[model samples]
Target: MDEDYDYFQELRDFLGGTFHQDISSPEQALDEYINEANKECLLFTIRYCDEFLTSNRTKQEKENYIQTNAEIYFPAIGLTPLIWLNNVVEQIKEAVKLK
Candidate 1:
């Protein structure tokens, strides 16, 4: 976890520059899906989740919100969701395999 490694940018560069010819479309699709997910989150989902922290809302209100809209707060609905989630798991597996 070198702070300067710029993992996301380097990964994007490697995908866009090194393997551009082979995986450009798939990468773009994935990138677009990520962007759409970001939009979905910031506009609707985050505010909904943030309401849980509201001092104005009672505990019952928080419970109602969670009961009604928990799924939207789960994030990363498709494509790379699991891949994004288990990044540590994937890295650990790779490290073990390389050992």
Candidate 2:
């Protein structure tokens, strides 16, 4: 949680400096700060999940856990954030391609 908070703070400072004087509203500010964080988190989560899937030991157990968690809990808690984070990821990817 502390690491997450620090990443967001650093993002806010970086983007705020870049978009200085144009960013408006708390929601906009948060969106700016969290967009990069969301991208990193999405990449990290997918990579970690893939690593867990590939691990020789307990691969089946990890698969069962992810399957059950997705079926039972992720629907209720995951869709919105996943969608929003995905959108942020696309934006970041596009930005990278342009540069």
Which one is best on lDDT? Answer: 2
- Model 1 lDDT per residue over 47-73, tens place: 322332433766665444333422222
- The CA lDDT of each predicted structure is 0.36, 0.42
Model 2 lDDT per residue over 1-99, tens place: 233443323333443453344555423643564455555554443344334435564645543443333222334434443343344445555544443
After TM-score superposition, the amount by which residue 2's alpha carbon in candidate 2 deviates from its true location, in angstroms, is 9.9
Which 10-residue span in candidate 1 carries the lowest summed lDDT? Answer: 40-49
Those runs of model 2 whose alpha carbons end farther than 4 Å from true positions after fitting are 1-37, 72-99
lDDT value for model 2? 0.42
Could you say which candidate leads in TM-score? Answer: 2
Give me the overall lDDT of model 1.
Answer: 0.36
